[model samples]
Target: MFKTTVTPRFGDIDGLKHANNIAIAIWFEQARNPVFRLFTPDLDLSYENWKLIMARTEYDYVGEMFYGHDVEIISYISRIGNSSFVVTQEAWQNGTKGAIGRSTIVHYDFLNKKSEPIPDDIRKKLEEHLQNEDNSCK
Candidate 1:
Protein backbone atom coordinates (compact mmCIF):
# COMPACT_ATOMS: atom_id res chain seq x y z
CA MET A 1 0.00 0.00 0.00
CA PHE A 2 1.08 3.56 -0.73
CA LYS A 3 0.01 6.33 1.64
CA THR A 4 0.28 10.10 1.29
CA THR A 5 -0.54 13.00 3.52
CA VAL A 6 -2.22 15.99 1.87
CA THR A 7 -3.24 19.24 3.45
CA PRO A 8 -6.59 20.39 2.20
CA ARG A 9 -6.43 23.92 0.88
CA PHE A 10 -9.07 26.62 1.12
CA GLY A 11 -9.63 26.41 -2.62
CA ASP A 12 -10.44 22.71 -2.26
CA ILE A 13 -13.66 23.63 -0.45
CA ASP A 14 -16.83 24.43 -2.30
CA GLY A 15 -20.03 26.14 -1.18
CA LEU A 16 -20.65 23.12 1.01
CA LYS A 17 -17.43 23.91 2.89
CA HIS A 18 -16.17 20.48 1.83
CA ALA A 19 -13.50 19.47 -0.60
CA ASN A 20 -14.70 19.71 -4.16
CA ASN A 21 -15.13 16.52 -6.15
CA ILE A 22 -12.73 17.58 -8.88
CA ALA A 23 -10.01 18.37 -6.38
CA ILE A 24 -10.40 14.95 -4.83
CA ALA A 25 -9.84 13.35 -8.22
CA ILE A 26 -6.63 15.31 -8.59
CA TRP A 27 -5.53 14.06 -5.19
CA PHE A 28 -6.13 10.49 -6.32
CA GLU A 29 -3.80 11.03 -9.24
CA GLN A 30 -1.13 12.39 -6.94
CA ALA A 31 -1.34 9.40 -4.64
CA ARG A 32 -1.28 6.81 -7.43
CA ASN A 33 1.82 8.12 -9.23
CA PRO A 34 4.22 6.17 -7.05
CA VAL A 35 2.58 2.94 -8.09
CA PHE A 36 2.98 3.91 -11.74
CA ARG A 37 6.55 5.01 -11.19
CA LEU A 38 7.36 1.68 -9.68
CA PHE A 39 6.65 0.22 -13.09
CA THR A 40 8.31 2.85 -15.23
CA PRO A 41 10.26 5.80 -14.00
CA ASP A 42 11.39 8.57 -16.36
CA LEU A 43 8.36 7.91 -18.51
CA ASP A 44 7.66 10.52 -21.16
CA LEU A 45 5.03 11.86 -18.77
CA SER A 46 2.81 12.50 -21.76
CA TYR A 47 0.81 10.70 -24.42
CA GLU A 48 3.91 8.94 -25.59
CA ASN A 49 5.57 5.51 -25.58
CA TRP A 50 4.35 4.79 -22.03
CA LYS A 51 1.60 6.18 -19.86
CA LEU A 52 -1.64 5.01 -18.33
CA ILE A 53 -4.77 6.98 -19.08
CA MET A 54 -7.68 7.25 -16.73
CA ALA A 55 -10.26 5.00 -18.30
CA ARG A 56 -12.63 5.32 -15.35
CA THR A 57 -12.77 6.81 -11.87
CA GLU A 58 -15.33 6.63 -9.07
CA TYR A 59 -15.47 8.36 -5.71
CA ASP A 60 -17.83 7.90 -2.80
CA TYR A 61 -18.07 10.54 -0.12
CA VAL A 62 -18.91 8.94 3.19
CA GLY A 63 -17.99 11.77 5.57
CA GLU A 64 -17.30 15.47 5.17
CA MET A 65 -13.77 16.78 4.67
CA PHE A 66 -12.85 20.45 4.71
CA TYR A 67 -9.96 22.86 4.76
CA GLY A 68 -7.63 22.55 7.76
CA HIS A 69 -8.18 18.82 7.60
CA ASP A 70 -5.08 16.76 6.92
CA VAL A 71 -6.16 13.83 4.81
CA GLU A 72 -4.55 10.47 4.28
CA ILE A 73 -4.70 8.86 0.86
CA ILE A 74 -4.06 5.11 0.65
CA SER A 75 -3.65 3.20 -2.60
CA TYR A 76 -3.27 -0.47 -3.49
CA ILE A 77 -3.28 -2.42 -6.70
CA SER A 78 -6.32 -4.64 -6.67
CA ARG A 79 -5.75 -6.34 -10.01
CA ILE A 80 -3.40 -6.30 -12.96
CA GLY A 81 -4.20 -7.43 -16.45
CA ASN A 82 -2.05 -7.76 -19.54
CA SER A 83 -2.82 -4.23 -20.69
CA SER A 84 -4.38 -2.48 -17.73
CA PHE A 85 -4.80 -2.47 -13.96
CA VAL A 86 -7.14 -1.37 -11.20
CA VAL A 87 -6.16 0.75 -8.24
CA THR A 88 -8.28 1.16 -5.13
CA GLN A 89 -7.95 3.98 -2.67
CA GLU A 90 -9.54 5.69 0.27
CA ALA A 91 -9.24 9.10 1.88
CA TRP A 92 -9.46 9.38 5.62
CA GLN A 93 -9.60 12.28 8.05
CA ASN A 94 -9.32 12.15 11.84
CA GLY A 95 -9.48 8.34 11.75
CA THR A 96 -12.85 8.38 9.99
CA LYS A 97 -13.38 7.38 6.36
CA GLY A 98 -14.09 10.40 4.21
CA ALA A 99 -14.13 8.94 0.71
CA ILE A 100 -13.42 5.80 -1.26
CA GLY A 101 -11.96 5.98 -4.78
CA ARG A 102 -11.11 3.54 -7.53
CA SER A 103 -9.56 3.99 -10.93
CA THR A 104 -8.93 1.76 -13.95
CA ILE A 105 -5.91 2.74 -16.01
CA VAL A 106 -5.13 1.39 -19.45
CA HIS A 107 -1.71 1.14 -20.99
CA TYR A 108 -2.00 2.67 -24.41
CA ASP A 109 0.13 2.46 -27.50
CA PHE A 110 -0.19 6.09 -28.54
CA LEU A 111 1.42 5.31 -31.87
CA ASN A 112 -1.26 2.74 -32.43
CA LYS A 113 -4.90 2.94 -31.39
CA LYS A 114 -5.37 0.02 -29.03
CA SER A 115 -4.26 -1.30 -25.67
CA GLU A 116 -0.67 -2.52 -25.24
CA PRO A 117 0.60 -5.15 -22.86
CA ILE A 118 2.87 -3.99 -20.08
CA PRO A 119 6.55 -4.61 -20.79
CA ASP A 120 8.37 -7.47 -19.05
CA ASP A 121 10.70 -5.24 -17.03
CA ILE A 122 7.84 -3.13 -15.79
CA ARG A 123 5.77 -6.19 -15.03
CA LYS A 124 8.53 -7.58 -12.85
CA LYS A 125 8.61 -4.36 -10.87
CA LEU A 126 4.88 -4.44 -10.32
CA GLU A 127 4.92 -8.08 -9.22
CA GLU A 128 7.29 -7.08 -6.47
CA HIS A 129 4.64 -4.86 -4.97
CA LEU A 130 1.66 -7.16 -5.19
CA GLN A 131 -0.28 -7.45 -1.95
CA ASN A 132 -0.39 -11.24 -2.14
CA GLU A 133 2.69 -13.14 -1.10
CA ASP A 134 2.19 -15.72 -3.83
CA ASN A 135 2.18 -13.19 -6.68
CA SER A 136 -0.16 -15.53 -8.49
CA CYS A 137 -1.35 -12.71 -10.69
CA LYS A 138 1.94 -12.74 -12.56
Candidate 2:
Protein backbone atom coordinates (compact mmCIF):
# COMPACT_ATOMS: atom_id res chain seq x y z
CA MET A 1 0.00 0.00 0.00
CA PHE A 2 1.07 3.59 -0.59
CA LYS A 3 -0.17 7.00 0.51
CA THR A 4 0.72 10.45 -0.79
CA THR A 5 -0.28 13.93 0.25
CA VAL A 6 -0.71 16.74 -2.26
CA THR A 7 -1.45 20.34 -1.65
CA PRO A 8 -4.21 21.59 -3.91
CA ARG A 9 -3.18 24.56 -5.97
CA PHE A 10 -5.56 27.40 -6.81
CA GLY A 11 -5.95 26.01 -10.30
CA ASP A 12 -7.00 22.61 -8.96
CA ILE A 13 -10.32 24.00 -7.76
CA ASP A 14 -13.32 24.81 -9.89
CA GLY A 15 -15.54 27.86 -9.76
CA LEU A 16 -17.52 26.14 -7.02
CA LYS A 17 -14.37 25.91 -4.90
CA HIS A 18 -14.14 22.15 -5.14
CA ALA A 19 -11.30 20.13 -6.57
CA ASN A 20 -11.97 19.57 -10.24
CA ASN A 21 -12.70 16.11 -11.55
CA ILE A 22 -9.50 16.06 -13.56
CA ALA A 23 -7.53 16.90 -10.45
CA ILE A 24 -8.46 13.61 -8.84
CA ALA A 25 -6.97 11.64 -11.70
CA ILE A 26 -3.74 13.59 -11.55
CA TRP A 27 -3.50 13.11 -7.80
CA PHE A 28 -4.05 9.37 -8.07
CA GLU A 29 -1.33 9.16 -10.70
CA GLN A 30 1.05 10.87 -8.31
CA ALA A 31 0.16 8.38 -5.60
CA ARG A 32 1.31 5.52 -7.85
CA ASN A 33 4.90 6.83 -8.00
CA PRO A 34 6.11 4.32 -5.43
CA VAL A 35 4.93 1.37 -7.49
CA PHE A 36 6.30 2.93 -10.61
CA ARG A 37 9.67 3.51 -9.01
CA LEU A 38 9.79 -0.09 -7.87
CA PHE A 39 9.41 -1.27 -11.43
CA THR A 40 11.80 1.25 -12.92
CA PRO A 41 14.61 1.81 -10.50
CA ASP A 42 16.44 4.35 -12.62
CA LEU A 43 13.40 6.14 -14.01
CA ASP A 44 14.49 5.38 -17.51
CA LEU A 45 12.23 6.19 -20.42
CA SER A 46 13.71 3.51 -22.66
CA TYR A 47 11.15 1.23 -24.26
CA GLU A 48 12.63 -1.75 -22.44
CA ASN A 49 12.26 -0.11 -19.04
CA TRP A 50 8.94 1.59 -19.61
CA LYS A 51 6.74 -1.44 -19.17
CA LEU A 52 3.49 -0.03 -17.85
CA ILE A 53 0.74 1.27 -20.05
CA MET A 54 -2.52 2.65 -18.80
CA ALA A 55 -5.38 0.54 -20.11
CA ARG A 56 -8.28 2.18 -18.32
CA THR A 57 -9.08 4.64 -15.56
CA GLU A 58 -12.27 5.78 -13.85
CA TYR A 59 -13.36 7.74 -10.81
CA ASP A 60 -16.28 8.45 -8.49
CA TYR A 61 -16.68 11.66 -6.59
CA VAL A 62 -18.19 10.97 -3.19
CA GLY A 63 -17.45 14.32 -1.58
CA GLU A 64 -16.08 17.76 -2.41
CA MET A 65 -12.55 19.02 -1.79
CA PHE A 66 -11.34 22.57 -1.44
CA TYR A 67 -8.05 24.40 -1.27
CA GLY A 68 -5.94 25.49 1.72
CA HIS A 69 -4.96 22.00 2.88
CA ASP A 70 -3.54 18.72 1.68
CA VAL A 71 -5.43 15.79 0.20
CA GLU A 72 -4.20 12.30 1.02
CA ILE A 73 -4.46 9.58 -1.59
CA ILE A 74 -4.23 5.91 -0.67
CA SER A 75 -3.25 3.40 -3.34
CA TYR A 76 -3.70 -0.37 -3.34
CA ILE A 77 -3.27 -3.13 -5.85
CA SER A 78 -6.63 -4.82 -6.38
CA ARG A 79 -5.85 -7.46 -8.95
CA ILE A 80 -2.91 -9.07 -10.71
CA GLY A 81 -3.13 -10.78 -14.04
CA ASN A 82 -0.57 -12.21 -16.44
CA SER A 83 0.04 -8.81 -18.02
CA SER A 84 -2.09 -6.35 -16.15
CA PHE A 85 -2.93 -5.09 -12.67
CA VAL A 86 -5.72 -3.00 -11.21
CA VAL A 87 -4.96 -0.07 -8.97
CA THR A 88 -7.53 1.32 -6.54
CA GLN A 89 -7.12 4.76 -5.08
CA GLU A 90 -8.98 6.77 -2.46
CA ALA A 91 -8.84 10.54 -2.09
CA TRP A 92 -9.42 11.82 1.40
CA GLN A 93 -9.75 15.37 2.59
CA ASN A 94 -10.90 16.91 5.83
CA GLY A 95 -11.15 13.43 7.32
CA THR A 96 -13.64 12.21 4.73
CA LYS A 97 -13.55 10.30 1.47
CA GLY A 98 -13.61 12.78 -1.39
CA ALA A 99 -13.16 10.49 -4.34
CA ILE A 100 -12.22 6.97 -5.38
CA GLY A 101 -10.56 5.78 -8.57
CA ARG A 102 -9.55 2.57 -10.32
CA SER A 103 -7.03 2.14 -13.07
CA THR A 104 -5.84 -0.79 -15.14
CA ILE A 105 -2.15 -0.89 -15.96
CA VAL A 106 -0.69 -3.39 -18.36
CA HIS A 107 2.87 -4.57 -18.55
CA TYR A 108 3.73 -4.01 -22.17
CA ASP A 109 6.50 -3.83 -24.68
CA PHE A 110 6.03 -0.69 -26.69
CA LEU A 111 8.46 -1.75 -29.35
CA ASN A 112 6.50 -4.89 -30.23
CA LYS A 113 3.14 -3.47 -29.25
CA LYS A 114 2.06 -6.43 -27.13
CA SER A 115 1.42 -7.10 -23.45
CA GLU A 116 4.07 -8.86 -21.42
CA PRO A 117 3.79 -10.85 -18.25
CA ILE A 118 4.79 -9.05 -15.08
CA PRO A 119 8.16 -10.09 -13.74
CA ASP A 120 8.27 -12.19 -10.57
CA ASP A 121 10.03 -9.54 -8.52
CA ILE A 122 7.58 -6.83 -9.54
CA ARG A 123 4.61 -9.11 -9.00
CA LYS A 124 5.79 -10.03 -5.53
CA LYS A 125 6.14 -6.37 -4.61
CA LEU A 126 2.69 -5.59 -5.95
CA GLU A 127 1.21 -8.51 -4.04
CA GLU A 128 2.43 -6.98 -0.82
CA HIS A 129 -0.06 -4.17 -1.37
CA LEU A 130 -3.04 -6.19 -2.63
CA GLN A 131 -6.48 -5.37 -1.22
CA ASN A 132 -9.63 -5.85 -3.21
CA GLU A 133 -12.89 -4.02 -2.56
CA ASP A 134 -14.25 -6.99 -0.67
CA ASN A 135 -11.51 -6.99 1.95
CA SER A 136 -10.20 -3.46 1.89
CA CYS A 137 -9.66 -1.58 5.15
CA LYS A 138 -11.89 1.43 5.37
Candidate 3:
Protein backbone atom coordinates (compact mmCIF):
# COMPACT_ATOMS: atom_id res chain seq x y z
CA MET A 1 0.00 0.00 0.00
CA PHE A 2 1.05 3.59 -0.69
CA LYS A 3 -0.26 6.75 0.92
CA THR A 4 -0.21 10.32 -0.36
CA THR A 5 -1.83 13.60 0.64
CA VAL A 6 -3.58 16.32 -1.30
CA THR A 7 -4.54 19.74 0.00
CA PRO A 8 -7.55 20.95 -1.92
CA ARG A 9 -7.24 24.43 -3.32
CA PHE A 10 -9.94 27.11 -3.40
CA GLY A 11 -10.81 26.22 -6.96
CA ASP A 12 -11.30 22.60 -5.95
CA ILE A 13 -14.27 23.41 -3.76
CA ASP A 14 -17.91 23.51 -4.71
CA GLY A 15 -20.55 26.05 -3.61
CA LEU A 16 -21.11 24.00 -0.45
CA LYS A 17 -17.39 24.27 0.43
CA HIS A 18 -16.90 20.58 -0.11
CA ALA A 19 -14.17 19.35 -2.40
CA ASN A 20 -15.73 18.97 -5.83
CA ASN A 21 -16.32 15.53 -7.26
CA ILE A 22 -13.87 16.14 -10.09
CA ALA A 23 -11.19 17.15 -7.66
CA ILE A 24 -11.42 13.72 -6.03
CA ALA A 25 -10.47 12.14 -9.32
CA ILE A 26 -7.40 14.34 -9.61
CA TRP A 27 -6.26 13.38 -6.13
CA PHE A 28 -6.70 9.68 -6.92
CA GLU A 29 -4.65 10.09 -10.08
CA GLN A 30 -1.92 11.76 -8.11
CA ALA A 31 -1.88 8.87 -5.67
CA ARG A 32 -1.13 6.48 -8.53
CA ASN A 33 2.36 7.90 -9.00
CA PRO A 34 4.12 4.82 -7.66
CA VAL A 35 2.41 2.51 -10.12
CA PHE A 36 3.38 4.84 -12.97
CA ARG A 37 6.98 4.91 -11.82
CA LEU A 38 7.05 1.13 -11.66
CA PHE A 39 6.10 0.98 -15.32
CA THR A 40 8.24 3.89 -16.52
CA PRO A 41 11.13 4.37 -14.11
CA ASP A 42 12.72 7.47 -15.60
CA LEU A 43 9.36 9.13 -16.17
CA ASP A 44 9.83 8.75 -19.91
CA LEU A 45 7.09 10.32 -21.98
CA SER A 46 8.21 9.16 -25.40
CA TYR A 47 5.63 6.97 -27.13
CA GLU A 48 7.91 3.99 -27.59
CA ASN A 49 8.79 3.86 -23.90
CA TRP A 50 5.52 4.84 -22.34
CA LYS A 51 4.15 1.65 -20.86
CA LEU A 52 0.65 2.16 -19.48
CA ILE A 53 -2.71 3.61 -20.44
CA MET A 54 -5.84 3.95 -18.34
CA ALA A 55 -8.49 1.62 -19.76
CA ARG A 56 -11.26 2.42 -17.31
CA THR A 57 -11.98 4.37 -14.16
CA GLU A 58 -14.80 4.52 -11.64
CA TYR A 59 -15.37 6.13 -8.27
CA ASP A 60 -17.99 5.96 -5.53
CA TYR A 61 -18.40 8.83 -3.14
CA VAL A 62 -18.89 7.63 0.43
CA GLY A 63 -18.74 10.91 2.36
CA GLU A 64 -18.31 14.59 1.75
CA MET A 65 -14.93 16.21 2.18
CA PHE A 66 -14.44 19.80 3.31
CA TYR A 67 -11.79 22.17 1.96
CA GLY A 68 -10.10 23.46 5.06
CA HIS A 69 -7.94 20.34 5.48
CA ASP A 70 -6.02 17.85 3.37
CA VAL A 71 -7.19 14.45 2.24
CA GLU A 72 -5.16 11.27 2.49
CA ILE A 73 -5.27 8.86 -0.41
CA ILE A 74 -4.45 5.19 -0.09
CA SER A 75 -3.54 3.30 -3.25
CA TYR A 76 -2.83 -0.32 -4.03
CA ILE A 77 -2.90 -2.84 -6.83
CA SER A 78 -5.80 -5.11 -5.94
CA ARG A 79 -5.56 -7.40 -8.91
CA ILE A 80 -3.00 -8.14 -11.62
CA GLY A 81 -3.79 -9.45 -15.08
CA ASN A 82 -1.66 -10.42 -18.04
CA SER A 83 -1.70 -6.96 -19.59
CA SER A 84 -3.29 -4.79 -16.97
CA PHE A 85 -3.67 -4.21 -13.25
CA VAL A 86 -6.43 -2.71 -11.12
CA VAL A 87 -5.43 0.19 -8.90
CA THR A 88 -7.84 0.53 -5.99
CA GLN A 89 -7.81 3.77 -4.05
CA GLU A 90 -9.57 5.53 -1.23
CA ALA A 91 -9.61 9.15 -0.14
CA TRP A 92 -10.14 9.96 3.49
CA GLN A 93 -10.70 13.28 5.24
CA ASN A 94 -11.03 13.83 8.96
CA GLY A 95 -11.01 10.07 9.54
CA THR A 96 -13.89 9.49 7.18
CA LYS A 97 -13.75 7.74 3.85
CA GLY A 98 -14.68 10.34 1.28
CA ALA A 99 -14.49 8.16 -1.82
CA ILE A 100 -13.28 4.89 -3.27
CA GLY A 101 -11.99 4.35 -6.78
CA ARG A 102 -10.52 1.82 -9.14
CA SER A 103 -8.64 2.17 -12.38
CA THR A 104 -7.77 -0.42 -15.00
CA ILE A 105 -4.41 0.47 -16.47
CA VAL A 106 -3.10 -1.52 -19.39
CA HIS A 107 0.45 -2.16 -20.37
CA TYR A 108 0.40 -0.63 -23.81
CA ASP A 109 2.56 -0.61 -26.89
CA PHE A 110 2.08 2.85 -28.32
CA LEU A 111 4.05 2.29 -31.52
CA ASN A 112 1.94 -0.72 -32.43
CA LYS A 113 -1.22 0.67 -30.90
CA LYS A 114 -2.00 -2.38 -28.80
CA SER A 115 -1.88 -3.65 -25.26
CA GLU A 116 1.33 -5.40 -24.29
CA PRO A 117 2.04 -8.05 -21.72
CA ILE A 118 3.11 -6.59 -18.40
CA PRO A 119 6.74 -7.45 -17.86
CA ASP A 120 7.58 -9.89 -15.07
CA ASP A 121 9.80 -7.41 -13.26
CA ILE A 122 7.13 -4.74 -13.16
CA ARG A 123 4.51 -7.21 -12.01
CA LYS A 124 6.65 -8.20 -9.06
CA LYS A 125 6.98 -4.60 -7.98
CA LEU A 126 3.22 -4.15 -8.26
CA GLU A 127 2.67 -7.09 -5.94
CA GLU A 128 4.49 -5.15 -3.27
CA HIS A 129 1.50 -2.91 -2.91
CA LEU A 130 -1.22 -5.50 -3.32
CA GLN A 131 -4.39 -4.85 -1.33
CA ASN A 132 -5.50 -7.41 1.19
CA GLU A 133 -8.81 -9.29 1.19
CA ASP A 134 -10.24 -7.16 4.01
CA ASN A 135 -9.74 -3.97 1.93
CA SER A 136 -7.31 -2.47 4.36
CA CYS A 137 -4.59 -0.66 2.38
CA LYS A 138 -1.88 -3.00 3.59
Clashing pairs in model 3?
Answer: none
lDDT of 3 at 120: 88
Which has the higher TM-score value, candidate number 1 or candidate number 3? Answer: 3
TM-score of predicted structure 1: 0.84
Per-candidate clashes come to: 0, 0, 0
Worst 10 residues of 3 by lDDT: 129-138
Tens-place lDDT digits, model 1, residues 1-138: 788888988889999899898878888888988887765576556666456777998888878888897999978777789988778788888887788787888877777778889788777766665564223221
Residue 75 accuracy (lDDT) in model 1: 80
Query: Can you write out model 3's per-residue Cα lDDT over 86-127, one digit (the tens) per residue?
Result: 999999888888899999999999998999898989989998
The order by descending TM-score is 3, 2, 1
The reply for model 2, stretches above 4 Å from the true place, is 135-138
Worst 10 residues of 1 by lDDT: 129-138
Model 2 clashes, total count: 0
lDDT of 3: 0.89
